[model samples]
Target chain A: MRIEIPGEEYMVSGHLACPGCGAALSMRFALKALGGKIIVVLPACCWSIIAGPFPYSSLKVPIVHVAFETGGATGAGVKAALEMQGDTETTVVVWAGDGGTFDIGLQSLSGAAERNDDFIYVCYDNEAYMNTGMQRSSATPYLSWTTTTPANQPKENPKKDIMEIMAAHRIPYAATATIAYPEDFIRKLQQANSTRGFKFIHVLSPCPPGWRIDPELSIKISRLAVQSKIFPLYEVEGGEKYTMNFEPKGILVDEYIRLQGRFSHLSEGEIELIQENVDKEWNRLRKKAGG
Target chain B: MKKVLTGNQAVAHGVLLSRAEVISAYPITPQTTIVENLAELCADGILEAKFLRVESEHSALASIIGASMVGARTFTATSSQGLALMHEMLHWAAGSRLPIVMANVNRALGAPWNIWNDQTDSLSQRDTGWIQLYCENNQEVLDTVIQAYMIAEEVYIPVMVVLDAFFLSHTSEPVEIPEGGEVDKFLPKYHARYKCDVNDPHSFNLMVSPEYYQEFRYKIQYAMEEAKKVAKRVDDLFAKSFGRGYGPIEGHLCDDAEVILVTTGTVTSTSRGTIARMRERGVKVGLLKIKMFRPFPREEVKEALRGAQKVAVIDRNISFGCGGIFGHEIKATLCDEEKRPQVFDFVTGLGGRDVTPSLITEIIEYTCQNERPEGEIIWAGMRG
Candidate 1:
């Protein structure tokens, strides 16, 4: 069965993304939704490589490859210049990896959000710093096995709540998305492109190499994440009002964890702990959305 | 329009006349006044540009690059620690060949946190690929900013018009702020050949393999070398229109002198006064004010100081583990000379302790007497 997606594809073939890379699919879906009139600000990320080297770009849109920590600020700058030039049409999208968004780029991201600069900032979270050989970043999930976070000592803390951080800035729109649901991802991107102020979308992209999952299981594992309530799909309009995009089926978190080798060492007791934590977080999101 | 303005005000006025489309900066000592005045210019509708008040110096430079990528003429200002903070982005701006002109008020870097006039800060970024143009006074500070845009755009290299922290940035002086029409003739509107455009999408400064990386670096090197000629051509055109032009190297009374003192920034004026006093006492003394530091003015520096029997450098900053940065470059430039003059360095008045005319005269006298530096550097004005 073929799904009817947007006909216009902005991403070209022969790019440098890994096989079944969720970030690559996310970029494809994002560019399809945003269309041709756009500038993609890519920080130092997998997309930096995925966009190909100089004189070679897989992206059909203009790409401004900036410093890792300067994505938000650079997008704001491009938007400001466009506005000054009487160009209010072209949209500026800052597509950064999780490390750039949650850790190194947080200050500039926060500053841009606080100023309400007009641009769409999307964080394609692949759990860890995959570009630098899967180093553990602030966005790395709990008990995930990164190179730095070995099996003996995995990440101890939960992933940073970046959407809530953006919400605290009272931006016009903030949403969580995933490539498993193309409509949800495209809708959030379109919504962000429509609004005037700062719009942030946190896309939970999966990584086959970094997550230690089979190449074909990238989309399946991504779907399991949302289905198991580990990664919820939601939106916060006007920063204060939260709207749940989809309710999870309340499946066992074990299915999602067992799919990736990163969580292969997790005992049954640890799996129960993760379920309790996910349940508490889901309930909190529900309460915030007035469910 | 001749106006009595400080160096900071002059830079703002220059930026205004150049029609900068995007201005981004963070407030630092000495550099603060430049951006503050630019903000007022933006607010009063005098300058039509997008003013971005960034959180840090790093973002300020990044924002300027971002704006420049979209074919927007951009400008920014910073000093000392601020310039140091924008170190990484500085390389990006130059390597990308963005042609973003910036005014860097030169101040000493901090350990004890002193915000004073020193050349160390700007000189520290010598390897960052920015064309460094040190200003001698308010007029040069103003005119250099205008000239910088023209030079940067032509050579595709970013320019940093540097001035002494407070000596030039804060002190008011008579400077001819060129009219819009005059500046229009000097510097036309910036139209980027390859910028971020929706119609023609491309990536800028992306990762390059080892095979292609050397070529890109060589291109930057070619641009820098080409800038020396471009700087001269632009200044000549500027002189043709404005009746005043400072070249890459300026020689004052060096035609028939035995000892010449090399200086940069605001101290050039003091060197002039010291030379005049020495001339009154029948001493054969001359002055060489270096305006351009990046291309190092190598051949021109050698030619200017070649006539003298002895040459002395008054460096306000030291390059730790070595002598003055300028002294090292000067020696390296003149090393292949068979008839090169005896050279020495006088390290003095650091942290804005005031490099007076009397101090300069003493250095001149010392240069006239010594064949070469006895030790490494002559610590002038120090208690030791």
Candidate 2:
């Protein structure tokens, strides 16, 4: 079987994204699948800087950089205005970071989801607040070393299950994709594009400097996250029917943890604990998928 | 057609007539009826607009900002706490230079948690780059909302049409609701000069270095200066269509008066009656109702109070530590004037305390009896 990716590129170069920035790559793929008929509602994220400064934009699409916690509401508004204009062809996509989706912007996002407002919300999860110099966010994994959560006292809480929260809203579409799988990423984005109301796509975006990984190893680490079953490639339809898009090799969590300095302080025992947690989550997801 | 409408319902009718393309709002007391009326209008097909019942006031304004960015005429309404919650978005809306109009029903902020009328809610937002026009009655509330869209769209600055809670928001008054065709002729459909478009794509509100950041703010200030003229011109145009006009400030019997009471919102109505009775009783008292507070009709204020020896600024809202918010602005406006009147700040009717005719008379008497203001703020009708 053959998989196809669109040749047309909506994102342009000269953006200020760091080397191997997964979030930036995610946007490139997103715009590729979404085509030119979209307006991006960007909140306070790394993309805010990566989209280039004033008088210079890195995308061929129009961008409305809104307040930090207003990603969902702003997108809803754009879609509403477009609906009023009788232009239903344009898709209003909210390109937000994990901090916006999981933390400060949660209420607005939830509000939009609850109302089943017609828009696509994409959260590029880099695990931490990478734009703000690698602070600990609710999306930051347990035992990860961030600027706020130092090595001695790493992040005590586990990464929030954002998918479950979004699924509870019973939105039309919700999916998880990573940059390592461009075909899957593009396919999911296209699927979200076609869906009518309140679609959410979660991309496990990697950060090089913030994740304490070699810039070149960003995509490799993203692949390992999926292979280890730590970050599953999946989709939820109407908050129920779950389909695992990519069946992982189900490797141990050590390979995913060892590539980055964020988890360097973790002992063998802690790695085992993380493995147990990942396995538990994988099992729960498998049961939901009726595997 | 003349209809007896509350200030809130008048706002809905104004928005309906103005042909606002999108309406996004969250319900808050005193402001709820405005949105409720709008919802019904949209449902009944009387207003062909999309009404977004957002979760919070922050989203309420944020959504409208997005709508306005995409070249849609948008509006929202909220009271004190809801307005306070929307403080961040208020700055965002103005900074983005989206000409969105919002009706703010004046309600007191909480600590002890009061939900009644006061000016502090909108007054505190003076520097948010929004043109604030306070209304003295329901008629002005409806008129100002329509004029706000014209003025804001002209200058590309957000405008806040503010009215007192309960007094104007709930009280019914006969308002001349203009026909849709006449309003359409007066305030035409909003066509954004710059907007988010697919054909001509651009990023807005991006990170700007110091080299160009100051210029953006300079333009906003420059636009504010332009808004003062636009506001007056829009009012003139509105009167040409609707047969009634409200200037930035209105002065009654100020030419030969010894004492002038400066007021805003519904209190101005009471002050008007008090000034007439005082004039009949052989006391030289005048009434100056400030309709626009933001691009604060400074020249009009100075001209009206030039002959008056004593000016009492009646504030239904306190600025805390400073004096009345309007009182401070009035004092600053007259600071450079050669024959400026002695401005006395009298704070009363806070937290919805009644600003009765007797209260107005007492405020005037206090201004007359005193040689100068004994203090920065004289607490009127306050228990010892």
Local distance difference test, each candidate: 0.90, 0.92
i-RMSD per candidate, Å: 0.9, 0.6
Off by over 4 Å in 1: A1-4
Model 2, first chain, TM-score of 0.99
RMSD of each: 1.5, 0.9
Q: How many angstroms is residue A234 displaced in model 2 relative to the true structure, after the best TM-score fit?
A: 0.5
Pairs that clash in candidate 2:
none
Q: Kindly list the per-residue Cα lDDT of model 2 for residues A152-212, writing each as its tens digit.
A: 9999998999999999999989999999999999889999989999999999999999998
**CAPRI docking class of candidate 2:** high
DockQ of each: 0.80, 0.89
Per-residue CA lDDT of model 1 for A100-187, tens digit only, reads 9999999889888988999999999998899989999999888777899899998899878888898889999999988999988888
RMSD from true fold, candidate 1? 1.5
